[model samples]
Target: MQNNFIFFFYLLAFLLYIPTLILGTFLKPPTKKQISPPTPQSILARIKKGSKYTKQALEDFEKLFLNAQSCDQTLWLEIIKEFALSPSLEIKEITSLQEKLKQNNPNLQNEIALTISVAIKERK
Candidate 1:
């Protein structure tokens, strides 16, 4: 009876172990998928894609600038809007660029100076 009990326990252990051994033998380990980084062209394309939205915002700003009754406040508003909507640049960098443009080109028109600053910053 004790021998029979031991046989039953061994049989149960074998039943559990055999399937796992068979599966381990038959199944391949999972491989890591290699993800390629974006090429410069692809990165540029994505930046361009996002720029469409920026362009639309700029167009709206242009319309607002054209129609504004108060140029002083409106120019500031447009500058703020441009900085706000600019793609992915750090705020401090944009601010510094704007300040440098303003200091260097004090005689330039506000809109033109802002346009130059934004163009320079966004390309980075």
Candidate 2:
């Protein structure tokens, strides 16, 4: 009787431990992968490919603004101008770009606003 009781106790512990291990394997949260931001050259390449102005492009452009302090001012200005003047962009899309510019770099807002206005006029 004593042997039987000990065996059943060990059996119960084993059963519980197995379920705990399985649950732990399944319930563990996934690790997030870190993705690097797009570079100016990459964005320019995308533009050169004649891809339409898109939300993803705008997001990548914003990333450039976030790193603007480390980038060449003149180069970024030219890139912004070129991006704003994209033939594929509609007036509304230009407006969205303007908003993004303002949000990312207020110092350049006025210049970009002017560029966006000119681009809108040219589109009309």
Candidate 3:
């Protein structure tokens, strides 16, 4: 009877251990997915989709520019040029928006200047 009891205990242990071992072999650990930062083109596209420079679009652009991620100056210039050339805005409105942009981002002075110059050249 003691031998039978011992056999039952071993059998129960084996049953539990075998299933765990099988599951461990089949299961895999979860992998982390890397999320990429926003691109200048995507931001520009969002701006272009709007009828005018909405507050949300400007905020998004500002966040992208201020982010530590490096982006091409040409793409930034293109976005500024697009903003400057938007038909819905008058010259005064454009200048006002430019001032607002400059005030918010002092580092963008040079790029804003270049964009204005390019817009002038394009207009002529």
Candidate 4:
């Protein structure tokens, strides 16, 4: 009976302390974290670094169409579609590239058609 009373007292004390500790923590306000502003050089450098996925896409594009560089217009479009859907390149890069290709090839300009054809098709 004595041991049982002591154990019950300790257990009661332990259970009571938990809520106070949690309440103290909850009452405290959160602090804001500081982040340094980006510099022009660093920003430009990051963009220049370019995404690795894009580089891989470019390499894949070259390999896939290596033998058929000047071949059918349709297959070229599919390859370009894959290139554009890559996480590597930006929308502008793909658009500018498509323009340049059209200017040079003329025949393959309207080949791929939409800007994000593959991505749009896949979403469905």
Query: What lDDT does each candidate get?
Result: 0.54, 0.70, 0.70, 0.57
lDDT computed for candidate 1 = 0.54
Better of 1 and 2 by lDDT: 2
Best by TM-score: 2
Report model 3's TM-score to 2 decimal places: 0.51
The 10 consecutive residues of candidate 2 with the worst lDDT sum are 49-58
Model 1, span 4-54: residue lDDT tens: 999999999999999999999999999999976433233334434665544
RMSD of each: 13.9, 5.3, 5.6, 15.0
Write down the TM-score of every candidate.
Answer: 0.33, 0.54, 0.51, 0.40
Off by over 4 Å in 2: 1-36, 52-55, 64-67
- Winner on TM-score between 3 and 4 is 3
Task: Estimate, for each residue in 69-104, the C-alpha lDDT of model 2 and write its tens digit.
Answer: 657767666666667767776667777767876787
The 10 consecutive residues of candidate 3 with the worst lDDT sum are 61-70
Ranking by TM-score: 2, 3, 4, 1
Highest lDDT: which candidate? 2
Estimate the lDDT of model 4: 0.57
